[model samples]
Target: MNRFLLVILFLFFALGAFAMGQKAVVNLDEYLLSNTKSGYTNVMVEDMVFSWKLQGQDIFVKIFAPLEGWLAIGFDPAEKMKGADYIIGIISNGAPMINEHYGDNPYGHKSIVLLGGKDLTGNKEGLENKDGTMIGFSIPQDPQDNFHKKLLPGSTHKVILAYGADKNMKARHAKRYIIEIKL
Candidate 1:
């Protein structure tokens, strides 16, 4: 009878530990949703949510869209898409990937590395779930690149938010918008 009781207690503790572990693993969508009230300025455009916070010399950004494809944000364009600095995040091959890009013309963009510019992207993360896709990343306020613009805290700038319908980066955006935001 004592051995039986011991076995029951061990199983109970094991199950409790397993449950705790599951709770400890955070869902990316839940984390991004929680940040809406946590020092992040959130903007809702259509079905997308753009959130950002400036901390020290770096700006942290999070984007949540109801798509399973790629999401991107462009900082200050010259004309149309010309001379814009873009950061794109996608879940490729079941993993998160980020790439820095430069708008070379009025209608298109290419990778910054391919354009002979240094990559300025900081830590990036992406996740795709039943609800949607979420991407979070960080970039310096002053990237010191010709194609990128300085993001001053008190300045207002034009930002472009776009997302595709699939994971193909070369595909056209399913939806895009331009908005003026004060950093």
Candidate 2:
């Protein structure tokens, strides 16, 4: 009986931790296809265009921009990139790739931490425009990582849309804007 009690206690704590983490993993293709989500579109000064759909706590976003190199959409940009998260989409070697990163005010390796890398192909997709590539992805309304900023529903936040020449994210961007998200 004691051993069974201990096991139950352990499971309870583990489940609690997972729920608090707020990771909320979601499949991009499944979420988009399951809902008849009306697209909410936004445009930046640099012509980097994006649209997002919100269903419950899931947010599906797609970004398309004119870039000789790469395009990115960042969330919660303030003062710098100190407390912002961004997903960069690039066409590399005739393929579409996605990288999740968090900015710590500066745009460099030391200031940014990578979360995950994704490939846009098959069911997980977006159209690649001639001028730029489109990347479709999904993130939670509330991120699990304590290091990232929180995305609140019905409330807008600062956003950054940028593009640069280097795939390494080292080049000076052709355009960068600290705009507001259309929440």
Q: How high a TM-score does candidate 2 get?
A: 0.64
Best by lDDT: 1
The positional error of residue 75 in candidate 1, measured at the CA in angstroms, is 0.9
TM-score of each: 0.81, 0.64
Clashing pairs in 1: none
Regions of model 1 farther than 4 Å from truth:
1-33
For candidate 1, lDDT tens digit of each residue in 79-157? 9988889989887766779888999999899999999998877778777765577788888897786877888798889
Q: RMSD of model 1, in Å? A: 4.4
lDDT value, candidate 1, whole model: 0.84
